[model samples]
Target: MFYLAFFYPVYLGIFPNTFLNNHIIVIGIYGPLALFTTIIVFGVGFPILRSAYISLRDHRLTVDVLISLSAIVTYGYSITSLAFLGRQFLFFDVATTIIVIAIVSNQIRAKYKRRAVRELTGRLRNAETTVYRLTDEGETETIAAEECEEGDLFLVRPGEHIPLDGTIVDGQGTVNEALITGEARPQRKRPGDDVIGGSVAIDGAFEIQVGENATSTLDQLRDLVWNLQADQTNAERLTNRVISAYTVFVCGLAVVTFAAWLALGETGDSAFLTALTVLIIACPVSLSLVTPLAIGRGLSTAADRGIPILDQTVLERITDADTIVFDKTGTLTTGEMHVADVETSEAADEVLQRAAAVESRSSHPIAAAIRAHVTEPTQSTDFERHRYGVTATIDRETTAVGSPALLDELEWDCPPSIEESILHIRERGDLPTVVGWNGEATGVIALSDTPRKRWEDVVESLSAENRRIVMITGDDPRVAQQFEDHPAIDEVFADISPEGKEEIIQDLKKKGTVAMVGDGTNDAPALTAADLGVAMVSGSDFTVTVADALVTTDDLLPFVDLFEIARKTRRRLVENLTLAFLTPIIGLPLAAIGAVTPIVAAILMSAGTILVLANSYRPIMSQDSA
Candidate 1:
């Protein structure tokens, strides 16, 4: 219909005196064709009309109503002219052209939005669905992930992805949970340790028992992203208001213009043409496209960089955060114990080897750290795990690796030097592990939670503009003191319970907008209380669900990127909105007079839409280049 309407004028210009252009031939054939074309356009545009009707029923005006009104008026006027004034006066092409432009513009806007959402969901929903399920006979069999119910056992091989959230029931492995927790470091999983689906087993193998509710973390994240993207943000609401008022004003003006022209004794055809121009010129296509396109691009770009914005409103709230609060464990630190220092009265290598031999058989985080520090552990026998530590015989000698409690349990004497070393290690906020042999404490392995790589850089960047950077932790003052002396941190609240964290968040809100970043169940309340909550992928399900945004990769650098994207997206929204309104502001008056025709109005509206689209894409394109 658009092509026929557009080419009819060219056909006339090329063969003005041809038989096809004869008055009788045009009336008998082309007139009906033009009417047929208008009907087809209307049919194609029924959804637009239906939307406008629904909006009117609810006492609301939208750009769809304005576009529908323009098409209806043009079609009605052209049909009346064709019946009485003949073919020369018929303006069927104008009606078809307007609806065609509206439809094309809407599709173009929807295409960009759909592409962004598709890309984001695709990245998050990459978990494997086929898995090895253990059958009643205790043999592994292939099965779909969804087919496995609660209490079902599954075996994951050395490099296979875990298919569902489950606890380790047997065996052990180093699982790379980067896709789920954003942490690049592979976690050691053993019996009783919970493992998320979608994480790959980097080494070893495990038998996992499905949780009570069998679901993949990847599925949860994908659903959450879709839900978040569907919501209307503050900016979208403001745009709707502007579009509604503009639609009402333009409709009223079109009616008044027709009345005034008729009152001035102008011909009815002349009055209707001018009014139709007014309706078409004031279409808010560009205005409607502004926020959504830019926001979609921003969301896609953020997701590509490993940050999924779960709430659209955060694009506005994130930049407003003046006080940034960080939960110490998992957020600032790696949340993994590492061997910071090793002290032994005897040869350090012999003591560490003996400790690592026993610790290697345990899944405790401290044991992992001790094992990680040793190059080669000697073979140990009679391995016995205890609440405080592990006891085993290494090299025909009984050895113990644990804390002071473990030494007392084993009736091993702690040397004064070893006791002093333990005290010093505790004073420095490190967990002290005592290694004993020959019935005496021999060494104190000092282990501490390692801070995440580039954490200091994150603090520095966030605090660069004098924004207050605060750290809150449930750890005792001694454990939390390591972060307190950081130059960029303005304050530190140690030994705060989960409830106390929420109270601190509320208190900080009293001063200014607060953004809390955390990755633990204990951080849920604080996350909900803050203006913006950012959760790491390693966090508990409750924490991730409550967070406004998620860091899909285990890295803090994305926070900087996230804030930058939000600011750029906000700027693009304003620029696009300005472009959106420029068309109606400048074209309406020209259309009200006789300066602009329906075709010219359509061209101007389309141009404005093109400008807004180009401007909306600038931020994402620039990010890609950078």
Candidate 2:
């Protein structure tokens, strides 16, 4: 349709006589075909191409408007030429219009594809990993993540993207799984614990026996993120509607103009030329460009900040978002267990030794922390493994301690002093786990993960901007309220199941758009349900795959940056839409009175299109600007 519109003038120039003589009869005879052609090309083909092009580019550009304008120009020329001619002219004009439209749309698609390739290449380069390998001198060596393979042992230093999925074979340390699960806590990893790829080792050194190769791990994650980002809802329907309506309206107006001219006693060529001019000038191609250019620029700016915007349409949704729901464990607090309190009947050193011995066999996070804090004692053949826990005789007593469930069968009772200590530890805001010997309580250890440093500030900033911050977590309510002193949080729902999170999102959606921020496998459903799901780079693949946006940094500062970028982008889109919506309404009246010639109308419309694009391309300010 765009090509036909642009080629209309050329057709009129070549076959001016035929159009003037036959336009009235032609419309009566071929009205259905012309209208059908317009619907198929402009209504369907243009939108399909435009959407596919935008998806491929991962960015919007100005050329979309040019394609639209060219269509209108062709139609305008065809009609104007016929309005002043006789008969004996036809095919050449239609052919030229078709050629121009096809060429311009093809060019736009090709350029966008090339640019997308470059961007993907750059991200692959920057998102690499480094692993340490054993050297001849019992030292270690560093290599790319992809170079490491299954069953190979590698050492992880603090602040590293775990190159592969693996279990720790030796040593102890705290690993930040925020990138994998969006948990802010640094989890303890001891021997036998499973560590995921792309997680940051926050504090500790570990020798890992690799379980999965880097390609299988992170590539799967990237694919998941891409899939989640591509899901669409209703926001994109507006652009589709505009494209559909514009095409039909332009074609109808052209046919009407042609008939009106012939009824005024104009020659067949003159009427055809006038009608074609209307078609070419009124294609609404420029109008189609307004929304995409705005969205594309916004997405590009977000990418620069390490935030992966999966669904570009979410940029518009952000403007209306009033409430932001956050998944607590990984999203708010760092989701790893830490040693909050220690209790013992033996000397601290001796107690640490015994606890480490038991914990070394457990893969739970609490066990990992305990193992890291204690000094390992080499006691040759000191214990015989019992089915419940482990046992070693101290004097005549069989000293044994393990899980609460296992110990309960022994009917072990805590002495008054030990019982008091356990209560004290639990009162200090930590979960207490009892260690026993024979049939008596030996000690109690308490553990809990702390919140991230920037948590309060992030919440406050969003609240100041009139954004409501709510927490949804599977954690106990008592643990979730530890940060309640921070005034930024408006509500909390603790111990929520995945289904519950989705239900909460549905309820929130009734008020307006809501953004769900989370970092765990359990958070995926809610992430998918919300208007926008923001996955912390430190979160899990499940969460990232379901999230609409990906924040690569663990820092909370980028969340603000992400919101601001979306806000500005939506602003630009609205501006473009306003210009597009108002232009033809004003321009058509002037053109009808002969106040604007076809060439002048073409230039004027193109100017508005250019302004919309140029405005959309406004540069994003530095993160410091936020």
Candidate 3:
């Protein structure tokens, strides 16, 4: 229909004066062909008519109603002229041309949007990851990664990806943690060290005991990217308001213009044609396309860079944050525990034996640090666990190993060396625990957690802005002192619980927006409580669901990239919307008067739409999606 509308006039001009001119031949062949062509063009107008009808039934007007009315007037005028005037006045060609342009432009817009979303969710596609799952018989059975569940053991070989988030139960390996941390260095993993799935074992093969999160972190990341790309943002609400008001303004202006012209003693057909021109000139394609195109591109581009925006509203809220709170463990720190010092009351060997005997029975990180220094097991039995520490029978005597509370519960007294050990640990930013033999303080165990490779850089970048950076931790006073002394960190809280973190976030909310960043089970509550919750992809599954956005890697470098994307997206949105509003506002009065013809009006509408589309697809701040 579009082609016929464009080329039919040229065809008629080339033919002989009387060619195909027989009344019977013209009526039977050309006449019927023209009628068939009309039906196809009318079919193209179906969507416009349907949308117009629905909008009218709801007592509202839309851009579709204006387009449909213009097409109807043209087609009806041409048909009535051909039937009654014994000659044709064809506007079907022009109407068909407009319909074609609208459909094609919308398709192009959708193409760009899908390209963005596909780039974000490309990694989410379910891929078959191989693994060696341990059977009930204690033998390895080859299986897909998804088939292995919590508590299942999987063997990973050199250069193979770790198939699940679990503890290293057997063998030793150097695993490249680049997938989670964005740092390419290989981290050595011994028995009992936690290994993240999707990381490659660089050297020796190792057996991992899977934890409760059975779904591969990469798989969860894919699903999260998909959701973020598809979800509608608050920006859409702003555009929707413009659409509603624009529709009413256009319809009401057309009616008033037609009435004023008729009252001025103009002919009915002249007045009506001018009204039709006004409607055709003011299509709102540009209005609807602005928000989705800009925001969708931002999300997809951000995702490509390993920054996943989980919610549309998060982009808006982040800019409003007055304070940025960071969790200590699994966030600012590496979350891995390392033995720092050992202070013995009597014999260093005796205190270590008791700590290891109880620690060896568990998979906790504190236990791993204690096990690293201890050599001999005391053949302990009847091990008991508590919130403060672990208790068991060691050397046929009851032994307690943990915090000061655990020692107090056992009626053990803190010796002078024990008090000095606590002070030393705090000075160096390491955790200290009291070790007791029977009912006397025997020694102290001090462990330290190191900061991430990019922790300082991230802190420096964030501190460059006027925003306040606070560190919240459930760790000891030593860890709290670490943040307090750091120049980048403004404030620090020590010995906070999961509930305490949430309470702090709630209090911060009263002043202004607060963003909480975390990557552990304890951080989930605080992540949910913040105005804008950002979780590192290395965090727990529960943490992922609660966060507004998630960085795919532990690299703090991408935060600057995230804020840059949001700023650019918002700028583009405003530019497109302003063009959509202004061009139409200037064109409407001209269309209503005799100043503009229908052809010129259609062309202007088409141009406005193209301008908006061009702006929507403009490249973001940086071309490097890397």
Candidate 1, residues 156-222, lDDT tens digits: the string is: 6544457789999887657766556768566888799998876666445578999977667457556
TM-score of 1: 0.72
Clash totals, every prediction? 3, 58, 0
Clashes by residue pair, model 3: none
Instruction: Give the 10-residue window scoring lowest on summed lDDT in candidate 3.
Output: 537-546
Worst 10 residues of 2 by lDDT: 112-121
Q: Is candidate 1 or candidate 2 better by TM-score?
A: 1
What's the distance in Å from true for residue 545, model 1? 2.9
For each candidate in turn, the TM-score is 0.72, 0.61, 0.73
**Candidate 1 at 152: error in angstroms?**
3.9
Q: Model 2 over residues 1-626: C-alpha lDDT tens digits?
A: 54355345544475454553576745653344345445544664465447546743663333343344445345444344344433223332342343334444345433332332333335654554556765545445678667876787876643334667888877566666654576755688878999887665544456787885444345645654444324433434666566556656665776677677778888766665565455445545455555545555666667667675666666767767789887766567665777677677766666556666544434334556777787554231234433344445544555554533335556777777776775665456565556766688787677777676688888888899998888886544555666555688889886564457879999999888798877633355577678888876552222234466777666667777877887776666677777765657777656554455555555555566556556655664554221
Using lDDT as the measure, the top candidate is 1
- CA deviation > 4 Å runs, candidate 3: 1-89, 105-109, 112-116, 126-145, 148-225, 229-231, 340-419, 433-445, 538-543, 624-626
Candidate 1 C-alpha error for residue 200, in Å: 22
